[model samples]
Structures are given as structure tokens and as C-alpha cells.
Target: MDNNFLPISREDMQKRGWDQLDFLFVSGDAYVDHPSFGPAVICRLLEKYGYKVGIIAQPDWRSTEDFKKLGKPRLGVLVSAGNMDSMLNKFTAAKKYRSKDNYSPGGKPGRRPDRATIVYCNRIRELWKNIPLIIGGVEASLRRFAHYDYWSDEVRRSILIDSRADLLIYGMGERQIKEIAAQLAAGLDVRHIRDVQGTCYCADNLDHLWDYVQVPSYEEVIASKEAFAEAFKLQYLEQDPIRGKTVVQRHGDVFVVQNPPVMPLTTAEMDEIYDLPYQRTYHPVYEKEGGVPAIQEVKFSIVSHRGCFGGCSFCAIVSHQGRIIQSRSHESILREAKLLTRLPDFKGYIHDVGGPTANFRTPACRFQTERGACKGRHCLGSNPCSNLTVDHTDYLSLLRALRSLPGVKKVFIRSGLRYDYLLAAKDDEFLREICEHHVSGQLKVAPEHVSSKVTRLMGKSGKEVYVKFMEAYRRVNQQLGKEQYLVPYFMSSHPGAGLKEAVELAEFLRDIHYHPEQVQDFIPTPGSLSTAMYYSGINPLTGEKVYVAKDQHEKKLQRALMQYRDPKNYDLVYEALVKANRQDLIGYGPKCLIKPRLEQDRPEVSRKQRRLPVSRRRSAKRQRANKR
Candidate 1:
């Protein structure tokens, strides 16, 4: 199977002696056999378990001909809008057309249409009116419920409703997919297949369901911001797999019921999924016009784990991957690294050996797996939880093994490593290991902001934790006789951050003598808490007002402050300093973010200087000008 991708054409399907495929996997991305693609994983998993699956990658959505190429699937059709939301993949944050798509062959654009899941499914249903359509992946999963659409600037109904998908499998879908496949194989009707966890479906009535909580209807949430906030809070609370209950929200006459998320896979299960004979590269079909560009970064990488516990306010990991961390076993990881060394393109370097948060290799607490994550709090946010399980022994051991593998020169932790977790580790062995062996040059960590108000709103630890982490990182590198550095990543114009907080972050950057080359302006991607705030100007959790930086000018100013040392940011930074009433910072003081304009560059100063006698005017010149 390594020599071949899953059958993408009818001839290839016949070559495998298949009369018809058990499923036809339709994706908005070109066919890539790598495990990173959801279509590849689900299709390959189905094949591994003896269900014939064929793929139709990026079918022409305008008509039914391309979908007809694969013929109707025997069991069902699985649809995904590539690896990202279609709207996001096609448009920039500024809503301009993107000319290239890494997920497409040759980095081509317009291969897949907007709202791909809905478009693809509509075509499929037109060709085969009653074929079961199950939609999953980022687009379907994040839009499983009614969500705020930044692009449309309106609240949209559940994607399940929009795509008319019979069922939606959300989150990382290994467990849910396997279970759903078995039930469907047994000849279950899509309408009656409601008991599966980590799934959502719609119905006209909900009398048959049990242990369900009803949230605000779609009409109410769309009509009122208050109702939207209330509904989102309830959805956020019950996301844990262990303790969550089935939740139902009314949309007109239809009831969209979401079952509890699928339980996180154990180490062995994760190992099996990754171990499935993945070719670990894009299919050869894409070799002509240059292979898929996205595979370049990941072909040499390993996904060491799934899920995250950091639960940043701006991130949607809590909703998508859940807060309970699930890692692959150390031996499983070592085996994969050894395989990477065997690849034709093998270099000595392994790009990354981590996922989501690189440092999280286990659950945050003893009870997080059997029970669920705690309510209204996180494992590491604002402050470490008293009961938090802070250890890095397993991750450290895994890193050591990969580096020791023959022909392996280096293994880097390119994924985001939670700095607060590093600070909370009771023993410093793991921190020491990363500093001594793994860091390529400078370790990147996200403190997000220094202002406590802003950090709290970002669901980040206080500045003191970042301060301690920085000292420890420096000390470890210094003791090891290494000249490595730390690159602190910050976010600007978050929900609670006003001009004051922006200036506070700028001051922290000044204190550290660091200037980020680029700063991320918070984009309100669907399903994030920060997006909820962006849409409603209200924190859903406490129902308190939040200051949203929505004005384009303010967003630019906030972003400019992050890179204030850049000469191009002078005007925006000046605006921020003045607006925050920190005009004292706009001068030539050592702490000033930027030097004040020269006398001639300022109209007032130049006018005053010109009116004075030559001797007096010379005093207004830059002091060192004549000396130089």
C-alpha cells in the first residue's frame, strides 16, 4: 500500500478487484496520502479495517460530472473542506482573494470553491439523491453549532444544517470514525444513527433523546447578542468527553443535537493511527506541476501528541481537540523517527517532534482522563492550578531517543511549547534538556501580553510566570555554555487590550530589548472565545463588557506597537503612546519606544527654531549633530 495512494479513479478501484468502493471520500484538497490530511486518515483507516474506500479530490463543484467519475460509494460519501475552512483558505483576513493555496497541487488557487463542504455535498446529492453524506474536518467541526462568521459578519446556522449532511463527526475523529463505520456497515440508517458520541445530527423532534440540555434557539441567538453569548457559554462548558452531556439547540423547526465528544485515544490507539502504512509524502500524481507545497514542512515531522491543556482564550483547541492531552508512546515515536531516516529525501534533520503544545505529553491531572477538565478554569492559565500535574520526563526521554537514532542529526521542537508549563515543572531536567540539546537557536514562547488584565483575558499566565521562565531558560543555556536566545511571541489588540495594555506590552518589549519582526493581529477565526468577544463585545462567560479592538486603525496601531522599533511603525506607535497618555514615552529617554522627531521634522519645533536667531536656533538641533 506504500507504493500506492488510495484509489482516486474508477480504473484504480477496479485494479484492486473492487466492484465499488465502500466509501467515496470527497475533499477540497488534492489527494495526499500523508496522515496529516483528514481525508487520507479516514480513508486509509477504512481500508485498513477492510472497507474499500476511494477518493475524489477537489471535484469540480459546478456540475455533477467529476463526482460521477468515482461512481456512487457503496456505503456513504465522506466530505471535508480540505484541511481548513474554505472561506479562510480562499480569502485573506482582509477578505481579499488569495492567489495561491498550499493544499492544492502546484500551489494553485480556485481549484476548490468557497463553502466547499456545502458545495461538494450539494453536487453529490444531486448526482445520488439519497446517498449518505457524512461531513467532518475543520470546516464542519468548528461550525458544528451556530457560530459567528467573521467573513460574513453574521451568525450562521450549524454547518450540518447548511451542508445538509446526515451526520457530522467533530474533533479528532479516529475513535468516532471507527465507531461510525461499524454502525454504518451494519446497515444503520443515517437518520437513526444518533447514539454515536462525538457526532451531531438534526431532527424535527427530540422526544427520543435522553440526558440533554437545551440551549438558545438559532433565531434567538441571531436576533440578540445576549442570547448568542449565553448559548456559547453553555457550549464551552460541556466540551469535555467524560462529563459532557448531549446538547440540543433549536434552529427553526429542526433540533441540532450534539453528542458528547469522543473520548481521547490512549497511547496505543494513537500509535496505531500513526503507524498505519502512511506513504508519509504527497502522492506521485502531484509530482508534475510541483508537489503539494504544504507537505514540504510536514514530510519530515512527527505529530507526537494530540489535544492541549493551555486553553488560551483566543484559541479554539478547547472546542476542537479538547483540553485532555493524548500523546503517542515513546517507542512509537522512536519507531517513526527511524522510518523517517529511511525516506528517499531523508536529511539528518527531523523538522519537529511535537504537536499542538510540544511540552504536553500526558494529561494535566490524574483525573482529567477518567473525568473531564475542570469547569471555568484551565490547567495553566493566569496561574498554574494547585493540582496540576507538571512533569516532562516522558517528553524529554522521547527527544533523547530521537537524537540518538542513527543518521539523525537533530530533532527540534518546532511546535508551540507552553512556557507556563515549563515554569511549573517541579524538576528542571526537561527544561535543561531542551536548552542543551533541542533548541535550534532561540526558543519561541508566547507570553501574549504583560498587562495582567490583557493576559487574564487571553487566558494566559501572569507576567511573573513568563519572567521566571525567561530567567530559567537563560540560566540553563548559560550553564550549558550555549549562546542561545529566547524569542518572545506576543499578541496585540486582543479583546481586553486597549491602548493602555498595548503600551504596557510595548514597555515590556522595551525592557527585554526585543523587537518582534512581525506581530499577529488577532483574526477572529470561527469558534474561538476571542471571536465571540469580537462579535458581541461581551465576554460570554461572565456576561461582562469587553473592549474589542475592531476599528481597522486601532488594530493596525496595536500591531504596530508590537514592532515599535521598526522605523515604519513610528506614526502608529506615536498615536498609541499619545492616546494612552504615555506621551512621556515619545521622547529621547532610554525607555522611550522610539526617538522623537527632529526639530525640522516637527512643524511647531521648526517654526519656533526658524523664528529664533541663528545662535538660539542651533540649540534646538539634535545635540550630537554638530559633534558628529
Candidate 2:
């Protein structure tokens, strides 16, 4: 048997002539043996450093047999709830069961339990009480502190507290994981790993928390919304690695201390991780069960960078990945594009080559790399920072390199772009190139909202930026003589979007003459500045009152306003219009979102009333009042 995959079974381990393993990696996903999967990267990194690692993926949590299949490792067990949070993977924003689990084999569901990290750790603790349990992933990283849990609808303690994990790594783990293995190999006690950067651990005393910045305690944040808001603001402020301090929150007698995030990876480090041998697809073992479905989107894609400094208030990037952007080398990306052409499924297309924000191939400016992203400000928000150096020359050259590959017919960038960043570029070279070759029919951009008030609440730029971007996109595509459309994504019911603001967004959509196929409802996920605002009726940073749509019915109205064309949303749209005192937008007029629910079907508007021209309806009402 080949060592193509890290041993998933004892037999595979024996094939490699190993009697013991250094780390037993457990994941909630089926073992795909690809770099796109975090576990694959960690295990491969360990293997490269001469650590014997074995992966037990999607193991049956009901018993300990699957957990012990490869036997306990000498060092510890690495646990992650796959690429996505288990709750998000299993449920929708509406708290409904998702029909399919894309990460599971054959699109199956229920392969892993809810809160898989906690469940897997419990099982490990029950079997081997002393074994080290390290937890990290989307769930653990984003939920690593006292924060909100939307599903449970409560202020939950850190995952380190609930999972009883020995160490919790946050953000990009490539640097942190290797440091961990080296320490463990050197016979350091796992509990003493509290000193490691980018990790959170539970300590029994307050001695180690001497230099840590203490936030509101668990009880304080849970009992009072004001306390929670204050705590979130402090938490948000101290997340940058360069300027961030150690944060400690008391959980009863114990303390959950989180060290500052790991420094962003260098170009060489990113290249090393990307250059490591990855099978590029799910293990051949999954070939019969239709293979892992998540691989289809990523097998041809390349992740060019790591973090986002955009600092969207509703996003959790600030809490987890940190604001510092760590990018891969152009050589590393070109090497991967060439590798994609060799795949049997190659159709001469490179699906995507980007990370969180595709256009962000470098630090916003040179100062960010040296001193770090500004702790007091955002790179892209209401206004681009003057210090922000926006250029697409490097990213443009990288795209050109990929497009020049021999078999590459097209190189499409499916990842979303930060339009503000694109607009800040010195020229339209990247813009023209994207419209001419990269765009596949329509380019999807996130304008989010048109109202400046709501956009500011969402920590987005002014509507004027979107207007400017739309004009530029059209101009570039027009110059290219292409008919590629720009599809702008909108979000409804975010903080500060009330009936009035929602109506304003509807008016903007009408003027644009575009009806969205699907609309997004602002989900208050853990660790986002928005979630704090959602739970507490105040903006954490500014201490200003913010309106949040919590009621299911009201949320539906806001969502329907965005997609008023759908027949199913007619009633909701009508109700929203009436609620906003916007009956003028309810008629058969060109600007109307929905026709006044027919006079016969509903008494909202009668035939004679409808026949009155929209321009004179108010005058007609005045005439009736005069006659009376």
C-alpha cells in the first residue's frame, strides 16, 4: 500500500511499518487527504516534521471503537469539526435542518453530531482521561471566548470551557501546529502550552493571567447586555497580534486565557504549506461513495492569501483570522495552476485563485506588514484609509501567469471581490482583464445595501462607492465589448435596517431594475461585532442604539422587500409597504415593487382608485375629502 494517505486504520499504519503514532488526528469530516481541508494540512505538516500522525475522520461518536481504531497516539489527539462549524453545517439561518451535508460522502447528512468538537472531546476524555485534547476549526476559533450562540440563544462560555480541551488554537494553524508538535516532542507538558501564542487554555489559577487584559466576566456579560457590549468592544480592540494583549475572562473560579493571535505567515511559509504533497482530491477510498462533495469546488481552486482587514462589523474575520493579511507567493500559485491542468477532470479551467478577499493580495499598505494593520481604524469602511496603498499589479501579474499556462483555456475568479479595494486601484488594468476573460457571464459583487445609514451599521462603505464601482464595472466591460452583467448581492434585516431602511433598500433595488434570486438575512453568528449588536441593542464601538430585526415576521418582510418579484413573497411585501406608509410603492406604477393586491382579491386598492393615475392619487384623495 502507498503512503498516499495518512493512515486511517491500524492496517494502513502497519503498511508503513509503524507500531505507534505521535498524534491521532480526529475530524468531523470524512478524510479527504487534500490541502483544502485543514486536518490534511496539519497532519501533513506533522508528518513532514517526522511525527507519526494518523487521522480518524467522521468516526462513530456512539462508541470508542472507531476512536481507538488506530490506537491512542503517544502525544495527543487533534480534533476539529471539519471546515465549517457543526451547527452551521447542519442547520440554516432559519434554524431548519439542512437537507444535505456537502462535506459528507455522497451529500449525506447526520454524519457528525451537533457541536461535534465537544462531543468528540467528551468521548476521548471518557476513554483516556489523561490524553491531551486539542480543538480548533471554524467553531472553536470563532467561539473561543464568552460570546453569543444564536441556536441556543444564550451567551455561551468559550469552547475551551465546554469542550474541556487542553489547548484551543485559533486562526491559521500551520505555524501554531508545528510549534505544538515540537513542544510535545520535547516532552513539555500539555498544560504548560498556555504560553503558546494563538492558543486558548483553561487555567486553575489567576497567577498566569497577570499581564492579561481582563474583560467582563462570564456572569457579567451574560447578565447584562451593556456589559456584553462593553466586553465585545474590548475584545474587538485587542485582537491584532502586533498590538493585541493577552485576554482573560473568568469562568467561575477558573480562567480562560487567550493569547494573542499568531503572526501572519510569510510568503515562504505559505509556499511551503502549498508545496507540500496534497492528493488534490478526496482519497481514492471515497471513489465508490461518490467521493467527498466539497472537493469539487476547491480541487481546481487556489487559496492565495489568509486574512481579511475589511473589518465588516457583521463578519467574524476580525475575531478569528485577525486583520493581518498573509498572502502566498505568485510562484506557489502558478505552480498549483499547472498542477490543476494534469487532473483527469481538467476542462482547461482554473476555478478560482483567492482567499477571504480575492483582490487583497498584499497588505493594504507597507506599514501594515511592518507595524501591523491599524488598531484604531479600518482599511476599507466608510472611506478608504489614506495610508491604504491599493494596487492590483501583483494580483494582475499572477492572473496573467495562470492564464498563460499551456492547457488553461479560462481562469475564472469565482471568489467575491472587495469593490472598494478594486476601485482604489491605480488603474483599470485588473478591472478590464476581469471583465474580458475572468468573468463567466455575470460578475457577482456585494453592494450589500444602498442606504448609507444601514451600510455604515454593517461596517460597509457608503452607497456612493457602490455607485462608483457599478459605473466602473460597466465602463470596463463596455470597453471590452462584453455583455457580462454585474450581479450585486444584497443583505436584508441587518442591524439598523428597520421598516424605513428596508423600504429604502427596496426603492434602490427598483431603481437598479434588478431583482435578486436569493436574499441574505443577517445571521448573528458567534464572534461577530454584529452578533453583539444583535443581542445588545447598542453598537459596541460607538454606544449608539441600533435596530435589529429579531421577530420572524418582521425579518420575513425585510427579506421579501429584496425579492418582491417572487410571487411567494407578495403578501409579505405588501404588508411591509403598508407598514412603512409606502402605499405609493404598492401600485402598478413602474416604480412599484408589487401591484396593489388585486382589488377583488384584497380591499387594499379598488378598481376606480387603481384607474386614477399614480401621480394624482393623493390629489384624488384630497378631492374626496373636499366633497365630504
Candidate 3:
């Protein structure tokens, strides 16, 4: 193997002067030696701790031949379904197969199968039945519990039970993987390794379990929607690392026990992980195939922090990365930026400097580090918490420092920026600085929907907050003599969004005279509160019933309303306006969403009007108007 990358083949292993590997990582994505890729991070971390690691990227699961090529590892095998969920990466919100997979070589499809973690593990088992198999990554972490699967439209068993792996690491696995490796190297049996934090393992019974919260069994959740909601609520509340307890759920005779999440890394720990010796690009083997397409966006980006406190229900960040923020020191980020300047393709532009939510450099409040995030309360929900700390001094300083670096012309904040948090800050320096230096031609923000009812269910601030932010943004841009615009992101067919609310959003867009180029239809991916609501027709946090657009046609109508100005969407928009009892909005007026159909084209027009000639119809209408 080249000293720059982990061994990929037996030949590479020979070149590395190694007879066998300590750990072999099998991923559903092409090998990209960058920190943004989860598999790469885990492999590099293991290698840093003195383990001989090799990667087998996107191995063929159709047969056992590819699984045996890596040979049996001395320690165990690590499996991941790449950076995204397998089903989500393969299919669209409409449940149609996508033409391409960005993570695959040359952006081609079918390189990885659906439910990749399960398939890969099955193939590995066929080759060696007794090897220790550990699964992690976004796919495994989000589906750790018995949760809703959008593609299957059913509540499924825990991934730990389904994959039949000895261990499943959830969340960020740096802390858990290092410990597991040490114990395994010490000759501990995989079956007996059940106490690691941030991991889940199956048990035959509860004989060794304690201080755990038992959720509804798999059968109960499958049998009843209320039970499913109850189970999701319990799982959601206990995700905190400080106050969280071990979560246990029953699947047939087997019990899947999940230990409390690993603590958020400190600044020093976060710096160490990002400072690993990464080649910072896709493996050379993929060069003939034009490289993995997913690297384009992240290749020049810097992850300044991890985790989010924005608390949007439709997002899975809180579920996977936890709400506690873990940020890298400014020195570490500068080092990475300096490295980017030396790359052969350096273009004097850093794509982004943010994570799940930018401008969140610290915990939501001072108490989150000592006590866990408060249960059942959001820091920046519709009503901001009184104790929430809204500050951007540190993030501003980092941006200023990066801008001052040599050969760096610009640094943008492309990640989701919580506008409500920005508006809440005591001073406007951060906002002013962003408007002056950070923003590109247009800034992208997520207002989601204008209706208060929908925003409330989304765990977002109301429309009034968005309106306030918009006004403030415009004022700041005018002061800076910049003409930047806001490209607000809107969603369609989310839970609690009926035709009435959809029409309201359409009207809001109409009044603004801005039509969105694209609309995001809600896809109920696993491990999100919105998906639970879509499955059970009830909000898990609160017991209130919510309206979900499950039928394909209704979803189409909702999506059309977001882009009502499109000529192709006229029919769907007209149907939605009538169904919403807002027919007044479909007329020849300045505020009308669509023009009235010609008399001859209107099937619903009265037969009397159709029977008269055009000239006579005008005369009759004038006579009737005079008489009235």
C-alpha cells in the first residue's frame, strides 16, 4: 500500500510489509480519505492508535468472493453504509430510484445494494461465520432502535438484531471504537463485550442489564401505532450523554441494549481527530472513474463544529450527533485551511466553515455541560428559552482570522445558519460581518413554511421571526452597499401541513413576488420526530393528532403549491386552491396564483354560458349588470 492510504488489496498489503491487518473496514462508499467521510474518520482513528487497518470500499455483495479477498482480520471487521443511509441514497422522496449515486464511482448507480449494512454483513457471515462484526455510520446509528422505515412503510427490528452483528456503535464512534479495540486486542470475547458506551449489543435476557429504560417491545410497536409513538418518545428523551440511561428494547426472545451515548469530545480531542494524516481526496483507484462526486462539495470545506441545537423536527442531527456542541479550536481549523492553500487545485476560496448549524460555537447554555439538555424543551423553538445563551463572538473571531490568512480570498458559511439565533444576539457585529464578507451572491436560509401551525410542529420559530430576520438582513445589506438576496428553503407535504396551510404558504410567496426554483418534498427518513408523526399520525412528543399527506396525489398538490407560478403546475395549483376553499385566489387579479381558464376550456363553466355566442354573451352580461 502507498504510505498515504490504507491497504485496499492483498498486493497492497504485501507492499506495506504486512501479512495481515488488525482491522478491515468495508464501506458502501468509494474510499475517500477525508474527514467528512465517516468510514475514513474511523479508519484513520484506528490507525492512529497503532492498528494496522485496511479498507475494502464498496465490495460486491452478490457473492462471498469479495468478502474473502481482505482475508480474516486479527481483531475484527468494521462495516458502514457510507455517509448516508443506503435506502435514502438510492431512492427519492417519491420512492423512485435515482439515476445516480453521488458516493459511487463516476456517480453511477447500483454499486451498492439497498439496506447495504445488512447485505454486507450477510455476505461476510457467509464467508466467516464466527468473526467479530461491528457496524457504525449514519445508516446504523440512526436505525439503532426499532424505528420507522420509510421505504418499507413498517416498524422494523433494531439494526443490531437485524444485521446480527456482535456490536453496533451509534453516534460519533471515536471514543467507543478506541475502547472496543483495546479490549478486543486484550483477548476479550466479542460476546462478552456489552458494557461500552455509545454501543448496542444483543442479549438473550436481562440477567446482566441494570439502570436501563425499557421501551415498548418490537411486537407491540408493530401491532399498535400508539405503542410505536410511546417507544419513540422514550428513545428521544434519553439521548443525552449526561442524564441518559441505557435503553433496552425486546425483539422476539432477544434483547437489544443500548448504553448511554459517549460524551462530547473536548476541544483538544476534537482537534486531534481532525489533525490526522489524511490524503484529503478520493483514492487513486477511482481516478479512472472520475472520482466520487460527493467529494466536490466537502473537499474545500472545514468542519468547525459537530452537533446542533437548532432542534428542527425534520432533521436527524440531534438524534445522531446529539444536541451538545463540540467545536474544534481555531488553531486546528487554521492548520487545515493552510493545508488547503497548498493543494494543486487551490482556488483561493474556502467553500464553507460550518457544521450542522453554523454560528453555534458553544453549548446552548452553560448548564448543558454539567447537566444534560433539558428534557422535552427546545432551546430555540417557537419561544426561545429564557436561559438560552445567544453569542457569536468566538465564531466571528474565527472567521476574521481565516479571512486574514494568506492565499485565502474568501470564506463562506454555507451550512444552515439559525437566523433566529442571529436575531437574538445582543449585538449585530456577526450579522454585519456576514453580510459584508461571508455571503456569496445569495444566502440560503430555511424558513420551511409560513404557517404558524406548521412551523410549531417543525420545532421552528414562527413566521413572525422569519419576517423579522428578513427585514434585518435587508437593512444590513443596504448599509454595506451590497445587493445580496436570501434564497429561502421551503418544504412540502410535511406533517401538520394540510391544503389550507399549503395555500397560505403560496399566498405568502405570491405577496413577496418570489418564486422558488425548487421545492423539497418531505421524505420521512428514520430517527426523526417528523418521520414518527408521518408513520403514526400522532406527534410522539405531544399526543396531538397531525395531518400527513401520505397519498401520492395529495403530496403532488402540496408540492405544486410551493411552485404555483410554474405553468406545468397550473392544474395542480388550481385543484389545491379550490380544495382549500380559496377560489378567490385563482382569478385575473394582481395577487391571483393563476389566471382563469378560457371559457371554452373550463369544463365546470355553466352550460348557459357555453350556449351563447361570444358577442351575445357580452350583451347578456351587460344587460344583467344593468338590471342588478
- Candidate with maximal TM-score: 3
Model 2 has an lDDT value of 0.87
lDDT of 2 by residue, 1-628 (tens): 2348888888889989999999999999988877789999999988988999999889999998889888878999999999998988998878889999988898899999999999999999988899988998888998888988888899998889899899999986888888988898899999888777899899887774657688899999999999999988887788888878898888899888889888888889989999888877787777798998999899888899988888788888877777878888888888888888987889999888888888888887788767777776888888678988788888889899889999999988887899998888788878888888799888888878888888887878888898898899888877878887889889988888899888999888888888888888888888888889999989999999988889989998999998888889888999999999999998767888887675437465567877787768778767878999
- Kindly list the per-residue Cα lDDT of model 3 for residues 1-628, writing each as its tens digit: 1348878999888987889899999999999999999989999999999999999999989998887786899999999999999999999999999999999999999999899999999988887799999999989999999999999888888888778899999998999999999999999999998888899999889978768899999999999999999999998999999999999999999988999988999999999999999999999999999999999999999999999998999999888899999999999999999999998898999999999999899999999999989998999979889999988999999999999999999999898799999999887788899999999879999999999999999999998998999999999999999999999999999999999999999999988778999999999999999999999999999999999999999999999998998989988998998899888988767888887667526655467876778798778778878998
Computed on alpha carbons, the lDDT of every model, listed in order, comes to: 0.87, 0.87, 0.92
lDDT of candidate model 3 versus the reference = 0.92
RMSD of each: 3.4, 4.4, 4.0
**What is the per-residue lDDT of model 1 for residues 348-449, given as tens digits with 9 covering 90 to 100?**
999898888998888999989877999887688887788898888888788888999999998888887888788776777888888878887888888888
What does the lDDT read for residue 160 in candidate 3? 81
Give the TM-score of each candidate. Answer: 0.95, 0.95, 0.96
Which parts of model 1 have CA positions greater than 4 angstroms off? 597-628
- Cα RMSD for predicted model 3: 4.0
- Error (Å) of candidate 2 at residue 518 is 1.1
